[model samples]
Each structure stands twice: as C-alpha cells, then as structure tokens.
Target: MIRGMAHHVGIYTRQSEQRASKSEASTETQWDDCVSGLPHWGLEPQHIERYEDLGISAFKDVDRPDYRRLLADAGAGRINVIVVHYMSRFSRRTAQETYDDLSPLLRNGVRLISVGEGREFHANNLFALFELLFKLQASHEESLNKSLAVRAAKDLEARLGGYTGKAPFGFTLVRETRRTDSGKPVSVKILTPDTEHEAPIVRRIAELADNWITENDPTGSVWKIARTLEKEGHKTRGQRMAKARGDARWDDKTVKRVLADPRIAGFDVESVYGTRKDGTRSTTVAEYRLVRRADGSPVQRYTPIIPAEQWYWIQGWLSDRHPGGNPHWDGKPSGLLSAMKLLFCECGATMTHGGSGFKKHYRCRRRAIKPGQHEGEVTIGAKGIEQHLARRIFAVMRAADDESALAVLAEAANRYAVQRERTVALEVTQERDRLLSERARLRRSREAHHADRERVMLKGGFVDDFARESWGETEQALAERMRSIDARIAEIGDSKAVGLPYEVWLTADTDPTGPGSWWDSADFQTKRAFFRLFFDRVSVSKARRWAGRGFPVETRVTIEWAGGVDLSDRPMVGVA
Candidate 1:
C-alpha cells in the first residue's frame, strides 16, 4: 500500500520499437516490476490502470496515444499516481519538458514512481526532482547523439545514389536491408518507375506541354493539363492518400510544381545560390537545382523521364516566356527605358511594365505593394515616354561639341557586351525575338496589300492615287525599319549583347528634319542601355488627362540624370 492520499495508479510503458518483438520483455517487465510489491505499497490489482504505447519512442514530440491518454486521465484526477519501469520509459524528452509536464501533475497532488530506479517522486521531494531532471537530461543527450549518427548515415547513402525518403508520385518505394560499418542492419529504399499507373501519366504530361508550347500557346497549358488529367480520372498523390477527401482535386499550381520536381527527372535536388553583379555566388540558397555527382552529372536514383537537356530547355523557355532572370542579366534587357527600371512614380515607386503586344505602358504598382495606402495609380504610354527620352539623348549629343552623351552611350554598349550569352538578360532577348516576329507579320501584311493593288490594276481600272500613296508609305516604313535593323546589327561589335562595337556607329546623325537619325538605327538593347545612362530615375505623376481626355506627358514627367551628368545645356524638350 502506498502511504499517501494518492488513490489510483496509472502504469505507462513505451517501447522504442525495432522490427523484432521486444514488447513481451519491454512491456511485461514494466508491468511485473510495478505490480510485484503492490500489496506492500498499499495497492491492489483493481486500482491499477495500464497505458501501453507499443512501437513508439519516448523521444520528444512523438505522438503516443496511450501516453497522452494517461496524462489526460491523470490531469482529470482519474489517476493520482504514475508508475514506470524506468524514468526513461515515462519520457526521454529534455529536462525542461519533464519539469513542465511532471511538475504540474505533482503539484496537482499526483505521485510518480520509477520501479527500476527505486525512486518515488512527489511535490515536496527536491532531491527526487533533481535526480529525475538529471536522468531526463542524460536521456535527451543520448537521443541527440543518435539523431546525428542517423543523419550521417543517410547522407552517406544519398551520396552513393541510394534513395532515403518516400518515393515521389510516379514511382513506388522498394526497401531492402543493408548493414552499416558496425554490422548494424539498416533499411535503404530504392525507386522504380510505376509503369501501369503513374509512369505513363508522367510521360503524357510532358508530351502535352511540349505540343502546346510548340504550337505557340505557351501560357495556359498547365491549367489545361490539370483539367485534362482530372477528366481522364487521374488523381494526385494527395488525392490518392486522402481516401476520405473526395473534393481534393488537382490544381494548376500543383501540376506546375509536380512538373518541375527533380524527382520526376530521376535526380535528387539541392538548393543553389544566386550570383551577385560582381559574378560571385551568394551563401544562402536562391533557387533549387538537381544534385550532381562528382563527375558533374546529376546523381541517378532511377531512370529519368525527362532528359537534362529537355528539362533545362523547357524551364528556360517558360521562365523567359514569362519574366524573371533572378537579376542574373544585369546589362541586357529590351524595350522602353521604363522596362529597365529607370521609370519611377512620383511616390518613389518603380514602375512595372503593363499592357500587352503593341499597347504597352509603364504603370505605378504602388497599390499592389502597399494596398490601402495609395489613393490612385500613375501610368505613362510606352511610346511617348520612350520617344521623348530618345530625342533628348540625341539632342544633347548633337549640341555638345565634346560629344559626351555619345561617349556615355558608347561605354554602356561595351560594358553590356562583356557578359556571356548564358547570362544575357531574358527581357532583351525576348524583345529581340518579339521584334523579329513583328517584322515578319508586317512583311506578310505588305505582301497581301500588294496582291490587292495588282487585282485592281489587272481589271484595267486605276488604283486611286491616295491608295497608291498609302502603299508607298507602308513600303517606305518597312524599308526604313529593315535598313535601321541592319545598320544596328553591323554597329553591335561585341558579344550578341552589343552585336558590334561603339567605334562602329558613334557618329552624329542629329538633324531633326532628317529621314532617320542614328537613334533609328540603334537596337532595342542599345536604346535601353542609352536610356539607363541618361537617367538615374524618371518620375511620373498620375495623368490628369487620359484616354480621350489626352496625354499631358510633357508636364507630368520629371527626369533625374544618371551620375548627375546633364547631357545638354539646352533645357530638355517634351519633358518637365
């Protein structure tokens, strides 16, 4: 009989289970020792309540059902005492956890007994509390050492192309026994493609994406594929796992993530750092890349569905087709000065590119950034602002005898060409490609117009003079653009970034009334570079007059020159 007010005794047992049956010795020993001298401690068999958590560890944070139930019952005053074969059987958590959990139980008139240690713990016993804390701390330290050793073993297995985690979606895990250096048996999992169900689906997904993008409909394919997969009655990994949750459908984001996973390509993943402007890699991981083996090839856990070449190409195309370069392309970007971040709102926010196709604009995205704080938005049409800045740059170069503006542009052009092709800013590269597409479309339009003009002439009818003039203007515009593009190509003397050198086309073509100036012959990239040099920041205010109201670009726009270097003594025209 126990000599206290404690009435009910809760016996808790946990086994840090391995594959073999340790339960008989582990659990029964705890029960036998606790109840062996029961009558001597003033207790009967009817007073004992058993709480056993089999195949579970006493380690911190493990979800042990019986253990929790025991604690719950004790807290509810159903059990006034807790008994364990060893103190470690009760918990291998940190001393803090023991103090936090057991202190409350003891304070609430509960007593704890450890049969193996021959110890009785109560609220008033300070030495017993100290002994319990010391033992719990030792147990925690031992578990910590075991965790480190496990991590080391797993790292070794991964290096040898052994799969360590659960198999990804398109594969099933096959685990086998392997012995460690100390002859301890360990389980290593291997991945093999699940052909009947998941593997074929993975291949089909890649094929559909490939065909859709090749057909020039690149943007919305992922969502379409998700819909297609659902229609075909395929389920996602989560959907398969959650048998009760029928509403768990596949979504575009999930599909995109699945498509991008390294596991699908049969390689382990690792996080890599982004490179700084000075060309050095950062310490923190900026993005994930496939883990490569020592020979510079990606480590293979199984046969790959998408080859590395195809995988890289698709990722690059999608990323470029959209807009993000991780700021890796520091010098190369195509389009209006605003696109390169020279444009700013009066509120000091950088303007983001807006609109689509030829209807482009630079818009202040402050509302998106701060939400309720901004009252309205600022917007400037790409055409007016770009043309205004170009005229100013050309004007300064023409008026200055030293030709300092030309020199500035020449340096920028050369500086951009130094980065390799792999590092070319995606925006500029996309711009050049888009322009080429536009030029081809225009050629087709001109061809169709010529055919219609010939039809009227063949009927022995006069094609109107106004119509003829319209054709001529169209033809002339086409020819001028073609010639300018050719000249720009010839002038770009460095890498594809520059196309040619500064010495090739630094000559002045400043006449305002001329058919075309040097500005006309500058490539989109060169134009962007020139603008970057000319302005540190171009501030814009919300247009008071817009749409049908009209463009007040001249008054609403302000400029801050780069390096505080003014390109002209003449007050800038068409700008505030």
Candidate 2:
C-alpha cells in the first residue's frame, strides 16, 4: 500500500496439511491478519483478489495452482500489492526458486508485503532483497531438517516393527494402548490382516498372476484384474475410507502399482538414488526402493500375503508388462474367441465380430465364387453365446468343487478329496494335495539349477561341453522326478473314477466372489483365455430368426470341449 493512493491488492494463503478435525483455521487466520493490517499502511484497495491452495506443499516437486495464478496476475500489473501473513507462506523452496518467483512481481512494480514478518521489500530495496534471500535460505534449511527428522523417526519405528502411515490394501491397523515411561497411555498400531474380506482378494490376485507362470493357464492383464474387481463390487482403499484423490474406481495402472508395492510382501521401503552411467550418484531425486539388508536380501516386518519367490517373480512380470514392453495381456478383451480364430461357421468359414451395440453378433462373411457353397451364413449373437459359454465353464468348475462328486472318486481332488483313488489298484496316500505339494517342492528345487546358468552367463556367456554335459545330467534327474509327479496326477482322475473335473485355476471356493464365480467377474482377455482352455472350437448354424434377448443360446451354439481323453471312448468302472 502507498500513502494516499488506491491500489489493486492480492492476498494469498495456503495450508500444507489438512486437519483431522476438518477445521481449516490456518488459512483463515492468515487472511484475517492480512485484511486487518491493511488500514495501518494508509492504502485503500479498490480491486481485491484472494488466492489459496490447501493441502499443497510449497516445494519444487509440487505444483501450486493458485500460487501460479497469483504470480501471473502480479506480472500482468493486475495486482499493485501482494500480501502474505509470513514470508514462508509465499514459499519454503530454495533461495534460487524463491528469488525467481518474487523477481517477477518486483520487476512489474508490484509492492510485496509480509504482514507478520514486519518487513517491506521492493525492487529498489537492495538491503531488504538480500535480507529476504537469507530468510528464504533459512526457511529451506529448516524444512530440510524437519524432513530428515521425520525420516529418521520412521526408520526407528520400522526397526521396532511398528507400523506407520495408512495401512495398504488387504490390511487393517489394529490399535493397542500401553503405558509409556511417564505413565501416559500411548496407542500403537499393528498391521493385521482383514481376514474376512481384504486378505482373500490379494491371494486371489496372486493366484491369477501365478497361473501364467506356473499353470500355463493364460496371460493375465492388470486391466482385466481391475475390471474383475470392479464387477465384484470391491472398492478401493480410498473409496472405502472416502478420503481418496484421483481415480474414483479401480484402474489398470493402479492395480499394477498396488501389486508392485513391497508392503504386500510385508516389507518397508527406503529412499534410494540412482547412479549415472559414469558410476557417479545422480542428484535427480530419491525413489522408494524396497528395504533390504546389508547382504541385499529383503527385510519383512509383518506376515506376508505372498512368498518371497512368488513376489519377486511378480515384480519381474510387471516390469516386463510396463508400457512399450512385452505385456502379459494387452488389457483388451479381443472379443470372445475371435483372437484365437476358434469360432467357425457350418461351412468351415471363420466367424468374426459384426454389427453394433445390442444387435452385435458374430458373422461369417460369405466367401467363394459359388454363392450356394457359402449358403445360409451363420450369425450368432455375441453376448448370448458368450454368456452361455461362461455358464458352461463355471458349471464344470462347480462340478470339480462339489464334495458330493468327490465321494466315490475325486476328479474333484483339488477341490474336495475323496479319499478313494479310482485308478489306484492298491491303497496310495498321494492324493491331489500330496501330488501338488511334491510338484511345488520339485519346482522350488528346480529354481536352484538356474544358478548354474547364471554362473555361465557371468563367466563370458559361453557354456563349455563339459559344463553342458553336467547340466544335462542334472536336468534329466529333475525331469524324471517331475514325470513321476505328472504320472500320479494323470491317475488322480481316470475315466473309471468319474466325470472330468475342470481344474480350478484360481482356487474358486476361497474367493469372496464365492465358488466358481470368476466367470461373472472376469475381464475380456481373461474370459477369452479360459475359453481356449476348455474349447477346441465353437460352431454356429444359420439363425432361423433374429435370436434377440431371452432366446435359448444352446440351440444355435455347438461346443467341442477340449480333453486329454475322449469320454465316449473310455469304459466305466462299475459294469456288471
């Protein structure tokens, strides 16, 4: 404000962190102080603009919107004076950054004022300018010291296995109160599983991810995983608590980021800086790297949902699936069996996506010179056929999980154990669990063999004949062991035992969506992959009429189920 002159004044206020009680007195107090002190300067403000940014830090990394707008207004001469309660309120960034922001206002002849600091600084005031720079330097140092103290405290808490920050997905914070040295009660929070709801979601996601690597089931996509979660009515951590920012629902990138977090494996993280190609430490910024010991092994603080091996592999998998890399699944549904080219017409022509929206269907384009040869073109409603296939696949999965079906023979051995093995001539203890347990043990053992390969690569990427011969022999032993396990697995569900059991890919029963409920929750890519597992090809006859809603899909779609052995060719056990 200038004596006996009217000026356009701008007031700016900000709050770094929101209060838990929902009261925002900090910004209001600053506004009140700035407004009350205006009369002391003997200035009448004709035009006024108030700028504010809440829950944003005045740092290099964070973008402050209102702050930027205020700067622009000052530069354009819209503000004759800019008022703040304190110098730090304008910025706590480094001296250089603080100078850059303030220089524009001073150059434009805008008077700068800090109501609390009792300092008057402008372009003409050289001593005051240096004084302000020194103040900015002090402010930055103070912020840096505070940040370091917070990090040190967090490190100490982590060492004591004390949980800090909001509990991530699949976990809940359990509070326990204890008396401190001075006899004051202090509440401590422990990260614990949300067993009934959240924990199982994580295991289910793990099972889906594990399928591609272990069962050779299908390539899983984070997009599809997100879609499945959406369909199953699973709210994100933010949406559940209702303090969330950004996405309103689950998304592919969000899913990937959540899975990549080390917290899922019960580990905390420390900020790690990257090194340049010349081997010098770069000053870009520190990234959150999973906390590891001096020996380079991960450290765990809580019970982990994933085994260390599986979790590490998942990290590798996600890295491969990053943008512009080789993805497990491209996050598109690819339209039923179209990607596989398994849907065919009666005349043997391949079917493809046609029509639009509700009228959308799979149509076989008429081909060949003679029109009669490609007569009665097949067109099946895509949604109806897809829904029907979903039911059939889930029904097969349902049969596998049914305990009653496993009583005489366990085609359902993986689901429910029928102590009786139909193919076993003599009594045997190796049921599905034992067989699977052994297979898992063999796989773990097989991982050790990879060290031999790694050693060769490190030693100039050449495998000598002698080393190859030794490795071959070692692999043969493991292969032979694996063959025995496979043979036992083959015997688990012989034709004489019962109908075929569709191996549950994702452990259906334990899922919150319930037994065999994955079909309803699956994304396009996932459903398409499962379709290939159960079907050789699906053919459709010519539609007699437009098979609209409520039409029976079975009458048009014919399925050829994939199997190791044709059921019709085998004999039953209980023949008189």
Candidate 3:
C-alpha cells in the first residue's frame, strides 16, 4: 500500500531536548509520536500507508521564513501543512505576516490542520475566516491584558510601603514552604539577611571620618578616609573584590552607598518612575519629602552605617573648619513663604527680601506707578505680618458657628458630586455613539470589498483598482475608529476630577483669647485635618521691634462681632 502520491510533510518547531530513560524527546517529536499510529478521521489505512511511503520528517529549530519557503514549494506540487498548535507552535508574532503567509497557501489550494486540536482540513471558507479572527483576537487580548495586569501590580506593590524592585544587594531571595498539623499549608516569611557582620565595618568608616576631621586637615574629605581604610586591609562584605572606582580604591561613594542602604537597617525603599506634563519620564526621589511620624516627633531617620554620635562629630568638626559656615544659612526667607512665589502677586512677579541685616522683610515687585492701578505699595515686614495674619485667621474661624459653617460646606460638596456624575454620564454616551459609528463603517467596508472582488473576478474588471479601493476603505475605517477613541478620551477631560470646594467662616465673637486657643485645644487628628484642608501655607514671621521699644499693638485683642455684619470693609486693630 506504500506509494508516492503524497511526497512529503515537514514539521518545524522549537523545542528543547530532554534526557530520560524511557525516551529522549522534543515537543515536535512528542506530537508526531502521538499522531503517527492513530487512525486519521478521514484518511483511510491506505492513505496512512502512502503517507509512510512519502516520508514524515520533523525539522527542529526552524525559523519562520524557512518554514514559509518550504511550505510554498511543497504546496506547489505535493504535501500539506499540519501544525502541532496554532499560535504557540507556529507564530511570527505579527498580524501582517500571518495574513501574507496563510492567504497565499489558502488561495493556492493548500490546507492547514492543527493535529493537537483535532481540527482537520476545514472546508467551509466563512467558518475558517471566523476561526482565524477569533484566535487572533484572543491572542491580542491576552497580550494587552497581561501588560495592564503587570503595570497595575507593579504600581500596587510600589505603594505597599516596601521596596518595589530588586531586593537590596545585601539580601537574597529564598523560597520557603511548610506544612501544618494534618499536613496542610502553613505560613511563610521572608528572612532578612544578617547584617551583624557588616555593622562593624560601617562604624569603622564613620570613626575614620571623625578622626580625619579632628586631625585638622581642613580640606579632609570622605576620600581620604576611604583610602586610609583600604591601606589598612579592610575588605568589603563577602570576600568579594573590594568595591573600587578607577585607581583610587574603595572611596567614600562606595561606603556611602553601603551605609545609606535601607536593607541594612531592616527597612525598605520604593522609587517610582512617572511621566511629566512635558511628555518625558522622571524618577521621583524618596517618598515623604519630610517625615514626621505618628508620635508628633521627627522620624528617627535611617543611618548611613555610621553611629549617630560619630556622624554628628564628623559633621560638627567639618562645619567648624569650613570657611562658608553652612552655605544654606544665608539669612534668606525659606519654607512656606519661599515656596509661594506664585500666590501673593497679581501680575505674577516674585518678591525679594528687603529688611537690613538679618531682620528681613518682603517688598512688592511692582513696575513703578502704573496707569489705572491704585494701591501705592503694601509693605509687610516678614514676621509681624505672618504671625498676625495667622493668629487673626485662626481666631476668626474658631469663633464661627460650627453647625452653620459646616452646612454651607456640605451643600457645596453636594453640588460638586452632581456635576461630576453628569460629566461621567455624558462621557459614556459619547463613547457608545463612537463605537456604533465605527462598527457601521467597518461593516460597510467589508461588504464593499466583497462586491468589488466579485466584480473583478466575474466581470473581468480592473483587479488592481478594485483591490486598492477596498484596502483604502478598510484603512479609512480603522483610522476613523482610532481617532474617535482618542478624541473620546480627550473629551473626558482631566483624569482626576477636582474635589468640591467647602468654605468655613470664622467669626470674632468666641475667639481663642476670649476663653482657650481653639487650635491648641482641638483634638490632634482634628487639628491635623484642619491644617491640611484650609491652610495652604503657614510662615512664622518675625515680630517687629525698633530701638529697644515694643509697641503696645493690643496684645490679645478681642473682635467686636456686629451680629452677622459685613465688617470685611472695616479697619481692624492688631492682635498680640
């Protein structure tokens, strides 16, 4: 029954070689073995016998171009294309490649069969097209879904109060598992690397820094200390080559990187990369610009493998010798006032420090006297203005009626919520309309292409022109849909909706000086929340003093509340 009717069937795939007592196998080999002796659904025993005569050869590690060429030559005369699996076994990972390779074979009477899936030579043209589209869509969706899940997981992990990337150099990841009573699953813990051995080296480095400064080198730096350590045969952690930079040996930079490493102190760090408004990527520094822990005290900050006292000693000694005397202390205004460059000025001009010597003040950044502009120039000295304004505002708010003020805030919040809901509804409607239009356009293009193809084949019309027109129409539809989606997102406006504005009016009747300072007397969390809500900036301005005389500016003054009157226009006296 062996014959030459079927010439050859080439199986090409990528598979690793396995070493086993029963059999040495590749994926293709395993698949072939499974299908070889099995009865074909349509192929008679004689056809199987002829297949053996034609010869079955499996080609491993074959690339896509080689496989396509082989398939093309085989389809011209004798042979069929049967893949083990559709996507995993045979994929170029490009939609165009799939279309080009498969379309030609299909048109030239070549057949495709997935032996593993038991899908033989499917004869129905429409069914085959649908199957191919379904598979392609599934593959596309799988890749996109995987990408989104990974991004979301990475973001969540970053926010989980720990390191989001590689475990610090000192640590190693180890898999752990355990069993409970009755052999059930138990708990797991990631063991931190032991730093007991490394802690001594850190202390030594700090001590060296302190010693170098005390020796009065004046220009003594971290580099001098590192070189001194290297000469003393002090090796780095783990018998590994000492961390070096160029010919200088392990320097301060190396020591610093190691000492500042959070892993050594049993803490974690997470750095996030994000895109800026200018369409560029940026990496944020450590979170918590300045941390104050729950205990209302400054954080017990991470150490740089150096004892606190030694580091302090080194810093103190360096400061004493350095000429500039801590360059940061230049008597310039800093903190909340320094950061508020945009808020104070109406014409968007930055103010300057004006006071003589260390007693600084802020002056108006104006362009002389401008036409139609009234106010001559409001000059507010730094400390007096800041403290007076803060105390006055706090006193006013504390004296206000709590229930009435909160009711106003609640109404404003409700209005904002309603507006946001309407915006969301509008976006959904617009998106649905866009999708419906795209679907219609796609359907029309498909129908037109089918009709045009028929005309070219049956009526002997210009094939090139018809084909070009059909492709153009399809491309147009695709472009339109893409544009619509992009436009829809834009119409949705900014991603994060601004929260509603809630106002609280502060009165002068029940002032803090009247009974108790409301701010100091309020609950801790309430005080914190209030500060976060209304107050954007708080600058402790210096009190005005001149020629050894303190002006009696009505210290602890009381406000006369004119019973829900508009006293905003009235002249107000100063408070202590």
Candidate 4:
C-alpha cells in the first residue's frame, strides 16, 4: 500500500492540454488532472512503504526489470503496487507497446490502484478495452481543435486581403497601413504583413529569357540561366548558392521556374495547386500579373521588349523568306480616306459602294430617284463626285488668294468689332442691376463663382433689350458699308476673285455625258475613306424621259465637308 503522495502529481495527459494551474480544482476520480495528497485521506503510517523500504533507494532504481518483476510477483498474488495516477508511473514509447508490457501484470492478481482516479486494475477484459477507446478519443479531439484554429486563421487572412500561404520568390510579406479618420484624432491599426514587394530581379530574369528565345541559343535553357545568375553572384531566397547537381551548374527545374514565373516581372502571380505524378503537391500557373493604374485599373504594361514596327518587318521578312508573299496589310499604310467612317447620311443609312464604268462612288443605300410611290433605286459612281468637289474647293481657295477677298475679310472683321464696341458702350450703365442679382443667387446656392462672365461683360458690356431691338438695323447698316467697300476692291481685282472655279459653275450649269474614272490611282481603303469624308451620299438614276425627251444624264452628289451642298442635274461620264 502507498502511504503519502507527493504534493502535486504529474498526470501525463494528451498533447492537446496544458498543465493545470494551482487555482484549478483538484479531482479525486478524474486522473486527467494531476494532483497529490493521496495518503492524507485515511491510510495508516505503518501501511506506507517509502522508496528505501521498498528496496528502491532512488527513483532510478525503479527500472523496467524491477517493474516487470513486481508485476510477476503481483500476478502470483504476492504483492500490490500503488500509483498516484494511472499515467504517473506507467511510461512507454507508445500506447501499444505500453499495453503489451502491462499485459503480464494484468494476468496476475496485482490489483493496481490509481488513487486519483479511484480505479482498480481487476485484470478484467472490459477495463482494458475502455482504456484503448479513451486514448483514441483524446487523439481525435486534439486533431479537431488544431484544425479549427488553423481554419479560423486562414479565413481572417483572406478577409483582410493578406497573403496566407507560402511566399513566392522575390516577394516578402510586409505590413499594410490602416487608418481611422475620426474627428477627435486619427488612429492606426497594425497587423501581420501581406503585400509583396516588387523585385527588380524578376524583370531581369524575364528579359534574359526573352533574349534567349529570340537568339535561339542552344545552351540557353532554364538551367543554364539559373547557373548564369548564380555565377553572376545572385542568390536564392535563402541568400545562398543553389547547390549545383551533375554537370549543370543549376538544374533544368530551376531555370524553367525562373522563366515561367510572372512574379519575376513584378506582378501578382496567379496559380492553382495540383498533384504531381509522384503524389506530391505542385503548382500550375493560370495567368501572369497585369499592369494596373493608380486606382488599380489594368492597362498595357509591356511592349514585348521588342519594337512593334521592327517585329512586323521581321514577320514579313520571314514570310518572304518562305517563298510566299506576306498576306497581311501593314497597318500603318498612308491613306486619304482615313476619316470616311465618320461620314453618314442624315437619313441614318450607311453609304453603299457603287461604281459606273471605272469610277467608284458611295451612295445612299435607301435612296430612290422618283418622288412618288414608283420611285426606284438611285446610284452614283465615286470618281465623278470626287473630281467635281475637288475642282469646286480649289476654285474657292484660289479665289481667296486675291486682294479683293482679303479686303472683304478685313472689312467684316473691323465692322463687327466696331458694332460690338458701340453696343457695349451704350448699354453699360443699366447692365449691372440684373448682373448683380444673378451673382447673389449663384452665391446662395454654394456654387463656385467664376469670373469669366464678369470679365467678358467688363471688357464689352452686353447689349440691353433696347439695343437688341435695333441691333438688326445696325447689322444691316454695317453690312452695306462693308459691301460697298468690297465692290470697290473687286473693281481693282480680277473677276476670278469673286467667281468660284470656272469649272464649278460649268458643272452646275451644264450637263456632262458619262461616268468618270478615279479608283485607278487609289486603293480600297483610300476610296472608302474619300467617300465617307467628301459626301453624305450620292443619288443617281438612268436618264429619265420627261415629255418624251430624255433628261440630261441627271444625278445628284451630296457634299459633306464645310456643310453639305447638293449638286443636281449633274452628268455621269462613261470611261473608255
């Protein structure tokens, strides 16, 4: 019989638990918590056998053989051994080994007492089974608790947009700043690091890989690249040489890793976890990092580290090298019809392609020649319209070169300025009342006040209602004065100064014979662009008979630039 127990007992519990504190309540039947003072309950002093009395002078004397021999004697009903707790004195490497070792003692008459647990080892089959179940439950509970804690941590990280798992090369987790803008005072929150820092080495690696691919270097595999990096004094994340294997300085795996890593280019990497053939975990890339704007909007980040124009030239060169002509259009070719796409008819129909003889034209797809319900389709060739319009514009520009046109422009500019000044001078005295009232209302609305209105009025006060009433009369007077001066200037200049291109009037006045040719000198894109910019649409019909005489090969070409004008009753010329 055990006499006095130690003050505190050591109950070896599962890995999940921490040692109980002194303030924790001690239990008599639960061996899960270690406690002592067992003999103090009721045992007599004579019944207690100290370590010396039991032939064990020191704790070390209680070896395995000693315990085994004690168990054998107990099995023969020769002795009983007492323990403060079941786990206190029972020590083995594993539960299975401990159970095997204790089997002999269980087969004997040794009734073991766990004073703390009030348990007696009666060598019963049910008792041994119960112990095994208890240990298994303890292990399962410990695993579940650990899994829950880890899950909670990962969820928190995702919510805060923090990195949760392993760090990618060239990136280190760093704390992000959070601020509170309370009225009383600002506050800051400090938390774990998560953001990746941009590394220049990533860019260097990509540039190197791109160069290798372009040059078609035989020795420039990923392994070679890593070796070169190491030779150049580069280090890994651990800041040491990556141990070289075989004849290669760096392995193939290392080089491939560097080339394929988008993070090397300083982008947030995207990857998915995968399992390898060897049943080991691995990673597969989904996409690379994107360049973002200041507000995190994506935009173009790289130009391939190659010149665009040069790249196109090389592609064409390669195509030609293969004995076939390049089938692609050089996107930068020059064109006169660049603005054609913006041209459309007021009727909201796109111009359709049409040509007569050799001349190409763009005409309204919906137009009909006749006004009544019987009106049929209209058509126009592109060449006829371009030539006619170009001639008319050339005429107007040339006419403007004369002294008479300049005189007219100068006279208009001067007269308008004088009229504008006089109107302001006469109205200033009464203009301030309304202006001030408007300003006050604008201020009350908390709207920003601008000085543009006041500045313009101060420079030239606006015309009042009374002045406005007579403004038309004053404008007419100014025009007559300018016209009279212009006519005098015209007398000194040639008649061509006032008349538009002599050809323009001829086209407007006389009818021509057949469709014209224009597309010979222009490509498809140029012709299309011209049609879009020069004319809204053209409407044409085969010569019609009115009163039994055929109307002069009549057509209408609608101009788009400088405000549209329609040239009607025009002739279409047939190309030889």
TM-score to true structure, per model? 0.45, 0.44, 0.29, 0.27
Of the two candidates 1 and 3, the one with more favorable TM-score, higher being better, is: 1
Q: Which regions of candidate 3 are displaced past 4 Å?
A: 1-132, 140-165, 168-264, 267-354, 357-359, 362-380, 388-576
Instruction: Please give the ranking of all candidate structures by lDDT, highest first, separated by commas.
Output: 2, 1, 3, 4
lDDT of 1 by residue, 96-121 (tens): 98778777888987878887787888
- Rank order (by TM-score, best first): 1, 2, 3, 4
**Candidate 3 per-residue lDDT over residues 303-403, each given as its tens digit:** 33443334434433432333212445442234223423321433334444466645756655676756654355534455554445445545433433554
lDDT of 4 by residue, 1-576 (tens): 222332211222211122233222222233333224344434322333221112121112233444554444445544444443434334423445555656676664333455544654546757654664454345444545666786786665545555565555545555554322333322222222122322445445555655644654333345555666777765455444223212344444654554444333333433545556776655455334333344232232222222222222232222122111234523222222222343233354445554545755555566554333233444444555455544433333334455433443333333222222222322331243344344455454322222543464588987587765565565565456556545544443321112222342234322322233233444565444333323443433433567896553223434433223322322221111
- Clash statistics: count for each candidate: 11, 0, 4, 14
Q: Residue-wise lDDT of candidate 2 within 156-224, one digit each (tens)?
A: 555445677777778888876655556766566778877876778787776667675464333566877
- Kindly provide the TM-score of model 1 when superposed on the true structure, using C-alpha atoms: 0.45
Q: Which model, 2 or 4, shows the larger lDDT?
A: 2
Give residue 196's lDDT in candidate 1 (0 to 100): 69
CA-lDDT, candidates in order: 0.66, 0.66, 0.44, 0.40
Candidate 2: worst-modelled 10 consecutive residues by lDDT: 414-423
- Candidate 2: segments with Cα more than 4 A from true spot: 1-6, 18-44, 53-55, 59-72, 93-109, 115-145, 162-167, 172-197, 207-220, 244-247, 267-298, 309-576
Output the lDDT of residue 6, model 4.
26
